[model samples]
Target: MNKLNIDSLNFYFSKSTDVNDICVKLKSFQKKSHQLYKAHKHREAKQIALAYLELTDSLITKNNDDNCLLENRILFLNRLCELEKNHENYDKAYHYLIQIEKTINDKPVKDKINFQHQLQNSLNKAVIKNHLNMPQKAIEIAKETFKENISSIYYDKNSIESLSLEADITKTLADSYILLGKELNNASYLDSAFYFYHKSYDAAKIYDSSAKSAAFKHNIAMTDVLMARKDYKGAINSINNYKNTANSFDYKHHEYMNKAICYHALKNSDSAMYFAKKLIHNKKDKCRRSNLITLYNILSKEYFNLNEIDSAYKYSKLEITSFEKARKNKEKTFQLLYNNDFAEAKKLNSQIIKQENVNDKNKLIYIFSIIIILLLTYLYLVSKKKETNQIILDLKNNNVVEKTEKVAYNINEDFEAEILTAINLMEQQDAYLQADFSINKIAEKLETNSTYISFVFNKHKQETFKQYFTKKKISYIIDKLNTDTTYRKYSIQALAEEIGYGSSSAFTRAFKKQMNVTPSAYIKSLSK
Candidate 1:
């Protein structure tokens, strides 16, 4: 074993005179390792932790009778786990967690200490699984651990240890739920996440750890900012308020990330890019793979916005590489676990086969369902084609007005007529040609609220404001296509942009809906 060169850790590799001496040295080494970790000297901290682990293992081997050494071994393993997890070396971290679990299981369940160790081990495993992107498995582990031990742990909530444990478990549950919700796009799962996060906050408060409470509180506020409310400014305010309270490297890193996300959402790309680059370039702190991916994506987008094609492409490639590395790491860790447990692997294989059989049945049903829907859509489009052709003929003949039966509105007829006239004047001026045009803008020009304009649109035009606006834009574009040969020569993208649509796909969808044929096909027919 190599000596770490620190005065405290130097004795780690040397032969000790007695078990007591070794135990004292181990304590010193553990304390020094924690101090190094808190100081952000992760490499030195890991070295010290590994040395402690080796020393403890050898001591345990020579003196299996000492329960103290066995407990110290678990501590060393947990230290290594924390170190590895901090650096995003999740496979190594998971290996250490598994060692902790085996160590705990080998011991006879005698006291609350062993039970606490077991619960902590389970929490660590769930956290590692979550980091590995197996959030459902994380959730299952957390749920099972809690369900199996709630009676024992719940009764002692007044104890700091119990409260801390509860906070950790609930926080893990919330983290898992957040990941699951994002993966599945389920609001209910996100709501469950918030509930658990609040529970975590409550527990942490009683645990009397300001850092822990602040962390959970930050989680809730950030979740609301990012997922639920999407209040970007509010997110920035929350992050700024709590940033000084971030005691750990993880929370500090999150502060940077959340700031970048909020700035990006607010269209402050420069600020976003600066913070993103700050996090990426910080050598003392390693970013999580997911955060690395997000930062790369932000940098790529910002560079693209500046028209720096090379820089954008560079970060885009980096984003993809980071994503692939994360995915492969998860697979590798999962395979490591699978290879370690043959019976579990066999069971998983059986389940996979059953799932495949069910999927095959579902595939056939989906294919038939798609075919039926396509046939119905085809018939609908055929009828719509006739209607569109008639409208196009009328446009060519300068007879484009279509009448709708007037509907009663709560607003007086004079007010309704005035709103209609304002809308017609805006349409005549081709105000919809602006890409940012909206009902609100029209309402502003008319000195009226959007609600009244929306009411008039719904009641008079028999369509919502959006639908009416889309029809007018499409109708104007169709008229241009009929009258202007130059319009037919433009590419689909150019045509879309000419009519204030952001992308060709959006234009094509709207054109197809209006004309029952794609813009490209319609243009080709006009050319013929």
Candidate 2:
């Protein structure tokens, strides 16, 4: 199949004046975009769909009374929503879904075709909501859509399209139910989830969609693994069974991750580490942030169990970084939804006033409620900023340095000298650069106990072991950041990793406590 060229599309759209010719071109573009999407060329498909939307918007504005053009506009929006949802760009998907909902609402459902379009819109909304973790709302929408589908199927029995819709709706219900069950720990909800999963699988088989059948089958197996908490052996068997049919990247990732979890639970550290490392080395780029976090955590624990302190610390830091990324993504999604909701509220308020049907008392209450919400949001942000500022101020005022005066201890002078010499040797070797370097490790190296090392530090060094260790590490990093231009070029995460810190935030806190400035500020000062 020939791909749609953007240049040719733009040129033809610009030159064409005939409505019939333009509509035909748009239909052709739609088919091409769908074909690319089916072929898994999502990026290309999105580009074509976006171009189609832009062209359709222009045509609709010029021909506002044309129902055909309006219907095509809805189709374009729906396609964009599907593309964004598949990419896990939930914010963009929700935006397109809102547009689709508004378009469908503006036109009455005059035929079975329009009713199907409305059902599709509802299904997309429910799926997006579920992805955003609003499972209850998702379930409500899915159930409503399922009821509509059943009604349509009663009249149009033996319709393959109806079976396809049934499969999609039930699968959505299963997913939402699972999420709700996990959140609330409700056994009934889990049972309902399994029921819907089986229903979805049966419908997919009847619809002759092998891909959908395989996907629902994987879902069932994974759910079984998750619920079999103490039965690691059973979980392993389920994962092995699913592995035979796991052709997609996501399915295979789940298979490996579950296997690693089961083996780790079974006390097979080597096998667990092998599978976890395989995931990282083979599919790191393609893996989701959450999956990377899980893999890193598994590897960290396995290495810790094997007494490989350095490897354990490295993977722990990676897990922390992945967790931070996932948190930021969630925050971004929430911010997008918050902004959209606020705008929608304003739009609804305007429509109510324009209609002039609402009484003044009710209008006052509605407006007042919106004002209160805005005020609360503003106050929450201000309070968060104040808390952060107070933390920085406290850190700046607190002294981390050891006192000059030290008290005498009853311990033998010869043993104190031996501990001091061991510490000096370790310092000279730069052993503190290891993240897991601690009093216990030093004691093990010196063939002594941690109590003796702690005693020496407290009685002679005038500081605790942790304080002394942190001071050494932070001081070294400070000197490097000042003199090494290459160090200044690194990101905070890279800088933290360089000094064996598990998280950038922890490094930032230490830097702030030591230098009374954040790492970024210190780096900026070096540039100046």
Candidate 3:
């Protein structure tokens, strides 16, 4: 063994000591939070407030490990969220608490037990809405909590017991705000949504929540141009805010969409169509299906006005299909109203008029209903058959299989079990998973187009390589970023590139597509 000395160990430790720096950061966060309170851009202010409140950790650095900071940590964290309310991005306000939970566990202190559950509850409320897809609601929650966190300067709880209970309640209130904001944004209420997002940003900024003030500002600037109907100003502002941030192309698409809509409002059909087409053909995964659908509908109307019947008809069909996919869920709803809302409404109105001839009216209604149901069912069956045929067609295109087996397993050399084991071997070795692991890399190890490898992995894993790798990347980033200061070196774009994306914008769009939260917000969770 090499000779080791206490002097050398102490010297190395001193070089990395961050306690003083942490204190300065903490105080700065506090000052910023209070300053933001006066601004009352409810969302923005709250994030600033949080940026300050999270500085409590300044007292607990460098293996000093005083258990006292736990209560204060919980306090600042919860307060940060309380201030954010449900300002669209509020769910992120509680992300810091998740880190607090892990830290407390490491401390092995029973007194901090309640804070753990409180943090979990906080996270449950503040997390970005994926299943609900409710952006508008998220905004509302973030705005409210932000104010609360800012205003409450005096806290009476002194005992650990009282602190624990208060933390839980505060955590819940903060989380509620975050959840609401996410829903609001998802609803396309971009202006109001961003206002709330600012709230979460303000609160998280004060404390160690994943939410951040800068990110909220970036989103606000972006959404204002795209969703608030303030085209020229929004576009100009977004360019400034997004210049250093991630998602430039996707962000620009929103501005383009807004301009397209503006041109349509001005009766400039050519300009309108140009922007609409750009949105439709955008390679960014951030393209909202709703925006595209609306654009298609508008384009068809414009073409109709120009007497371009073929173009009109084509776009109209696309609009109908988009609706069928989004609202009717590819006609899985099979509701007559979805198929023919006006006709269904007229039938119901007519039923009242023919009340005197009850039997005939009922018979006619029944016949119509039956016809619609049959038609819908037939469409559904045909769609399924077509889908089945598509798989066969794809196999034929690849020339991988000889006969079409509609119900057969996706078996080729691609989905073999041996391939997955090799991939899993690499995954298990890492402390946290790496998303950048490619089929080619795995194949190289096995001495085998990662395409075939991924095919095998997914066939065996029942997920695409992108999906599996992305999830792994997300899971690792989420956990590691929360507490590891060394991670600060990586930029938001770097996160994507590290995870095998061609560029930052692609990674960001893909992440939002997969995880629902932007890269900036995700990074904030770490420092929070």
Candidate 4:
């Protein structure tokens, strides 16, 4: 079971349509299937469960209630229960568990021979009740199960399986308490939730396997509870306390995201962005869409607050895209559960079969459409880049000319020389190396109106105030990078800070525009 590779089963099941084909494949891959189910790959687990049910329906007529066949039905039913519960389809989960209960009753197994199976049946029932928002009912059933299985307390805690069962029971109780707390809006109930969650963590920590994975998740839930109470600092403390344990279980991404949310709630945008960036950098397709949406929103707002419009727009687009996709997936899941019955799922699958050819044709059309869009986007970007390059070249070659327009301000040659001298003095002193430097600030220092300053730059320098200021700052940074070895070793953010460019991305864009290469590329060429 430990050596099973569920991921490889995907290849064999890729185009399977017939129940018999799916059943044969699943039978050979049962161990891997369970492993996948435990890892929360719910879609794959659901497919296997449905295929098993279809095969069982076809075989039960001939087998006449074979114990092995019935057992397989029960296994898939429990997996279905878990899958439905995870999708928040509580009624569907309850239906699956009710079927499990009926199957177990018909089998009439002795407790000594099937204690674990019976225990799981009871636990699944309680979990579904909890998810249905009946916390008291869930707790009542959970306590009854504990009373019935008191002997489990004497079981070996060092065994991973035994610890996992204990952890499951404790986590369920914790969840029940948490739900009750939310329903009643009672703070005291949270104390009980924490107590049981910690107990679950302790039990799970006894083994370095799936049990420990549960521990990390439970610890993170505790932080969520703190966050719900508006205790952002407490949430941060919990995260720090569990950081080492989290890293050991590949939970570092979750930790970083939770920390980012807590910091965002505290209005610490800089700290929030740091953790958000950490989460985004290592994100994978398997990452939850909800988390990705939240991270993107955080980044967008943080950058907007910092006055980095380009960065803000970039993340805002990502947030909107991911959010729409997430919403679509949610809709599909809701549609699947609209009937809340296995027969409806089978009927849906039959409809899918009837529509397969049409779907395939639509898929081909989608693929071709995507290809055309990507090609056009590439061409458009290339054209835009060329246009930007030409503009930069013109700026550098002194070929830029202001459009001729009548103005009442007569440009005296003497006044023009004074303005140019003042600009030169400011440039020599590196006055542009300030985050808030603007034409208005410059006008105040030069004892003139901002319009007059803008007029001087546009008429004499042949550039807007912003363009000339950016050029001067970028030029200064380029000189430092070429001559100062220590400055060259600085990170993009550090260099941006030293040169007062507001942000590294802004600095990078300006450098590329003026020098026809990125700052990093320019530094690399210097090394060459």
Per-residue lDDT for 174-220 in model 3, tens only?
34433344434333434443444444344443433222234534454
Instruction: Supply candidate 3's per-residue lDDT for 75.
Output: 45
Residues 249-305, model 1: lDDT tens digits: 356666788888878878898789768977886776778776787787777667666
**Model 2 clashes, total count:** 0
Q: What is the lDDT of residue 506 in candidate 3?
A: 76
Q: Order the candidates by lDDT, highest first.
A: 1, 2, 4, 3
TM-scores of the candidates are 0.56, 0.55, 0.31, 0.51
* CA lDDT, candidate 3, residue 191: 41
Local lDDT at 1 for model 1: 20
lDDT per model vs. reference = 0.74, 0.72, 0.52, 0.71
State, as a TM-score between 0 and 1, how close model 3 is to the true structure: 0.31
Model 2 C-alpha lDDT per residue in residues 336-373, reported as the tens digit of each score: 33344334434433443333344446669999999999
- Ranked by TM-score, the better of candidates 3 and 4 is 4
Worst 10 residues of 1 by lDDT: 336-345
True lDDT of residue 382, candidate 4: 91
Error of 4 at 428 (Å): 37
TM-score of 2: 0.55
lDDT of 1: 0.74
**Which has the higher TM-score value, candidate number 1 or candidate number 2?**
1
**Where in model 4 is the C-alpha error above 4 Å?**
1-28, 37-46, 84-95, 108-115, 128-137, 151-163, 182-185, 206-218, 225-230, 241-243, 246-248, 273-528
In terms of TM-score, which candidate is strongest? 1
The Cα error of candidate 4 at residue 87, in Å, is 4.8
Better of 1 and 2 by lDDT: 1
